[model samples]
Target: MRFDIITLFPEMFAPFLASGVTRRAYASDQVAVRLWNPRDYAQGNYRRVDDRPFGGGPGMVMLVEPLQACLDAIRADRAEDPATQVPLVLFSPIGKTLDHPAVEQWAQSPGAVLLCGRYEGIDQRFIDTHVDAQISLGDFVLSGGEIAALALLDAVTRLQPGVLNDAGSHQLDSFNPSLDGLLDCPHYTRPEVWQGQEVPPVLMSGHHAQIERWRRDQSLQITARHRPELLAKARAAGRLDRKDEAVLAKIADGL
Candidate 1:
């Protein structure tokens, strides 16, 4: 899959694309990434990409002309059929909040054009005319969409086959379907004794069934305490069996 990122600060992504385990995806072309600067397509000596808003906003708005030009260049470079052109995605607070499901969708897709807005925001006209989708990280705001774009890229890249050292690693990740959308259980490593605490005896018992049962109990307890809504969803989806309910009941009873 390929992603063309439009940003004013293309320099910011250089280090990120090269670092982290996800870099394997980029290096192997499993998740191809290209950075494009709107400024490069801006006209005149100043090469301006932003301007004062017409409605008297406090901050400048990204110009539609430069962005349109950049998008045009990307379209031509990709040479994709108009009918099959990939979606253009903009990161904004008004969009759907990004989540595990969205990342999974993008991972299997042909990829997209990611617009990283700067200053106050992008010109509304351009967004309405060209963008195919919008995604948000959360309720909060950021200086630019660069961070959000990177977050999405990383999430999608890590899910590509062979990107991680262990093939089944991501399947056990929190929010994955294999875990029934539950948060992952706590993990302890190496030390038979750490400070004053010993590893849970079940973990060292060499009994797989008992160990899995212990982990499931821990996951249910942690999710109930930290994110009860997720536990409720799991129950509503009929993902919880009799044994799972028994564990949750014990937790609720403070046992």
Candidate 2:
């Protein structure tokens, strides 16, 4: 898969591509990432890409012409590949909040054109005409969409085969269907005792069934305490079985 990102600060992505476990995906071209600077397409002595808003806004609005030109160049570059039907995604607060499912979809996709907006925002006209979808990290705002773009890239890249040291690691990740959309249970490392606290006895028992049961119960308790809505959603989707319900009921009774 290929990801073409349009950003004013392409330099910001340098360390990202070169560092981390996910770098394997980028290094092997399993998930090719190309950075495009909109300023390169801007027409001016200074190559400006933003201007004062028409309605007299507090911050400048990104210009459409430079963005359009950049997209045109990108499209022409990808025109050789008939199978490259990429979505133009813009990161914005108004867009759907990105989630595990969305990450999974991108992991399986051919690629996309990620537009990282600056200033107040991208021109609405450009968005209406060119953008295919919009995604948000959360309710909060950022100085630019570069961080969100990086988040998407990191999430998707980690899911690529061979990117992670363990092939099935992501399957056990929090919010995965394998865990019925529950947050993962607490993890323990080599030391059985830490800070004078012994490792949970079940983890040391070496009984596979008992270990699995303990993990599941911990996951259920953690999720119910921190994100009850997710547990409710799992129940609504029929993911929680009788045994799971019984455990949760015991937790509710403070057992």
Candidate 3:
């Protein structure tokens, strides 16, 4: 999949694409990323890309012309017709909050054009004309959309086949379907004894069924304590079975 990012600070992504396990995805073009600087398409001695808002605003709005030109160049470069189905995505607070499901959708898609707004924001006219969808990280704000874009990239990249060393690792990730939409259980590594703590006996027992039961119980306990709402949703979806409810009841009773 190809992700074309429109940003004023293209340099910010250089290290990110090369520094992590996800780099394998980028390097192999499993998740090909290309950065475009709107300033490069701006027409001026200084190649400016932002301007003061029409009414009154503290920060400058990104210029429409430069962004339009940049987007045009990208479409032409990709030989994409004007009516092509590629989605132009803008990151903003007004959009849907990004999540695992969205990442999964994008993981299977051909690619998208990601607009990284800066300063106060992008020109509304440009967004209205070119953007097809918008996404937000959460309720908070950021200086730019680069971080949000990278988050989506990393999430999607790891879901690609062969990206992780363990093929089934992601299936056990929190919020995944395989875990019945529950948070993952705590993990313990290597030390038979650490400081005053010992690895859970069930983990050391090498009894697969018992170990699985222990982990599920731990996941239920942690999720009930930290994100009860998720547990409720899982129940509403009929994801929890009688055995799972019995485990949750045990945890609730201080077991």
Candidate 1's error at 49, in angstroms?
0.4
Local distance difference test, candidate 2: 0.94
- Quality of model 1 by C-alpha lDDT: 0.94
- Residue lDDT tens for model 1, 117-230: 999999999999999999999999999999999999999999988889998999989888888889999998888898999888899899999999998888899899998899
Residue 153, model 3: lDDT of 88
Using lDDT as the measure, name the better of candidate 2 and candidate 3: 2
- Of 1 and 3, the candidate ahead on TM-score is 1
Error in Å for residue 92 of model 3: 0.4
> For candidate 2, lDDT tens digit of each residue in 1-255?
999999999999999999999888898899999999999999979999999999785999999999999999998988846364799999999999999999999999998999999999988999999899999999999999999999999999999988999999999999999999999999887788888988899988999999999999999999999999999999999999999999999999983
Candidate 3 colliding pairs:
none
Q: How well is each residue in 118-234 modelled by candidate 3, as lDDT tens digits? A: 999999999888899999999999999999999988899899999999989999999898888889999999778999999999998989999999998888899999999999999
RMSD of 2: 1.4
Total clashing pairs for each candidate = 0, 0, 0
